[model samples]
Target: MQAECPRQPPFNCSCTLDNVVWDTSRLYLIPIITVDCSGLGLTELPGVLPSNTTSLLVKENQISDLRPLVNNEHYRHVADIFLDDNLVESVAVLEGSPWLFNFRVFSLRGNRLSQLPTYALDNALERNRHVVDIFLGNNPWQCDCLFTPSFQVNTEEG
Candidate 1:
């Protein structure tokens, strides 16, 4: 079935779904458009995201898994994502997702994550070494040899 575009401003730069807005202003020569759906108390990832979305902000929700991103085409253009303060425990959903290679930032500062898939982390870090900024602090992280070796730590805080 064909997906319908959500209601948004006539600027053709945003799509709204169930009170969630997917910003696409970057396509109109405006400031970088970032889809901000934070603090919505949502339990599942939204079904649709515009392919033009550059930054996705879905923090402070109840989302547990990220597999839905792989099921849609919108994930390809995403450069950054903010999923902090959620219920995410496993990111194995993103194992073979090509989007990891081009990500500029991925924040999961406050979640339920205790472990990450090693091979996925290694592949993402190696391919996008100088560009990706991954944040995984304040979670129930199991500090072990397997987890420690793949990721780099930032000593300073923002």
Candidate 2:
């Protein structure tokens, strides 16, 4: 279900329209299980979604905070989220939400995150230790005493 730019893209878009559709704010819904919206003029996610959506493949966009996405009914079911190459500076917006804990793969490869936000991870479902892959490669991880050895071992071997 992963989609990419076919030829001269943002593939589904047309250069003839002067890319006007990219400016409008609306939900891009499809019955597919995966979607890729990279290299678009998107600064934020569209305001709505279909509840059946699972994997949202938004690798390169202008999105930063995840707070706004909390209200989406399908937000809880998102397990594989590809959110690399964005403007996300901090993971604070992910806090105060209960649904984000079930996430199994969260990729933040090219953002401005200084440290992996452990606050939300600590509060995750205790029985749900299934969070497997986390990509924090390009960010500055704050490796400090507060980041005990237990935290490292509990999750993946970052």
Candidate 3:
């Protein structure tokens, strides 16, 4: 059967509803919605996403701001977000964001980030220590004294 893509604004992307096994006790199939908008040469995230989107892939784009991700209600259920090779410089927008606290996998690999808002990231990691995996590889990080302590704490605890 053909999967119906969720209703959203026009963007050069594709969506899939894959049957995934949820809890072992329940033994039921759940449709996991994944939206792929990678390598589209976009300067920012799409204005809206499907409400049921669980995974979002927007790698190799020119997106610099993360405000949309934090402000948009459509991203509330998203768990995994791949933003590798984007132009994102700061993650301060995610501070105290509910989605960040519940995220399972957040990849920012190969971005233009030099410094991080430690409190936001630290809190998110602390809250979801076992489940969340945040990738910060390939960024030009400034490991100053201010950035070191929190980074050390997360590294030691994680």
Ranking by lDDT, best first? 3, 1, 2
For model 3, give the 10-residue run with minimal summed lDDT. Answer: 1-10
Clash statistics: count for each candidate = 0, 0, 0
Q: Write the per-residue lDDT of candidate 2 for residues 1-158, one digit (tens) a residue.
A: 12221223333321111111222356553343444556675666544433444556667788887775577665666676778888888776777665566777888888777665575656663535657777777766667887745457556643
Kindly list the per-residue Cα lDDT of model 1 for residues 9-101, writing each as its tens digit: 321223333233435764343234466667777776665665456777878888887876666676677678889999999898887777777
Global lDDT of each model?
A: 0.69, 0.60, 0.80
Each candidate's TM vs. the true structure? 0.72, 0.65, 0.83
Task: Report the poorest 10 consecutive residues by lDDT, candidate 1.
Answer: 1-10
Error of 3 at 29 (Å): 6.8
lDDT (Cα) of model 3: 0.80
Candidate order by TM-score, highest to lowest?
A: 3, 1, 2
Q: Number of the top candidate by lDDT? A: 3
